[model samples]
Target: MRFSAGFSRAAAIAGLVGFGVLIWAAVISPARDWATSNKVALQTSRVEAARLDASIQRLEQEKAALGIETEFSDIWQARQIGEATAKVQAELGEIARAEGISLRSIAPLQSPDIPFAQAVAFRVEAEATLDRVVALTSAVEFHSPVLIIDRASLRRLTRPGRISPQPTLLMQLEIMAPVFIGEGEP
Candidate 1:
């Protein structure tokens, strides 16, 4: 009878210990895991927010450098439709001469009036070294009345003289200039 009682007490103590271990595994371990995951998520969110802030700052700097704010304030600088074609031709000729690009031909195409503006189309054919052609196009882009290139095609020109081994490029460009209807010539 004494052995039986001792056995019963030992079994009860063992059962209590097993129950404690089960509780620790089921509840405490899961709570710790949840907290750790939440910490990781919060850190990820902070990193993403920092990246977005940096992107916004970069975009703002680009806007400022473009002078967009000042460009739009008081007046539109593009020429009126009536004066744009002639002015654009003159400007393009001057740029071609300065950039050392051979001007083959430049002719203004007749286009219908666009809303509140005239769309003046011009076709330019020129031949030069690739570098000189690039320079000419860049100069045209920075010109006051904005010139938009609609179509461009480049072909390798047959070398006429043994001046240089570098292949020359013949560039055909179609450009569009938006001339506001009511604006005056500058």
Candidate 2:
């Protein structure tokens, strides 16, 4: 039997179309899906890297601030224990005089043994009004050198014959000054 030319041509065209569809299903479709997933992963990684960079900048700023505070504290440190105590006493006397407070006594106490530094303590007794005492305490706190008020006591003074308008208070303060030991010192 002889086949028609039109029928053979149509069969060949259908075979070519079927082969093209098979190749697309086997290779090209899976490759396209993989490329799409990799693009999404790249975007996510970029976002994470930006967030980490911002956090690093913030930490650096905090470290710089801490360094400045440390330097400021170091500038106020004293070298010798006895000299620090005497200087603290003189400063207290000056503050009392300026605030119109009468300083009864200023005596040094036993120094405390601290690591890398010595703490020189003092017992200060003064008589003044409440306002004057408050002013004196403020002066000590805001002074250039670092002065710590370890303990404070205020009591009303009683007089037998003399009746005054404003009551006088006896203020007792325990102040500490830190003296840093240098490398060259013994």
Find the candidate with the highest lDDT and give its number. 2
Considering only N, C-alpha and C atoms within 3 Å, which residue pairs clash in candidate 1? Answer: none
C-alpha lDDT values of all predictions = 0.77, 0.78
Task: Please name the candidate that would achieve the greatest TM-score relative to the true structure.
Answer: 1
Question: Cα lDDT for residue 126, model 1?
Answer: 84
Listed in order, each prediction's TM-score against the native is 0.62, 0.55
CA shift at 60, candidate 1, in angstroms?
A: 5.6
lDDT of 2 at 83: 62
Off by over 4 Å in 2: 1-69, 72-75, 113-116, 183-186
Q: Write the per-residue lDDT of candidate 1 for residues 30-80, one digit (tens) a residue.
A: 999999999999999999999999999999998787765434212223555
**lDDT tens digits, residues 44-82, model 2?**
999999999999999999888766734335323445656
lDDT of 1: 0.77
Name the TM-score of candidate 1.
0.62
Residue 12, candidate 1: Cα error in Å is 2.3
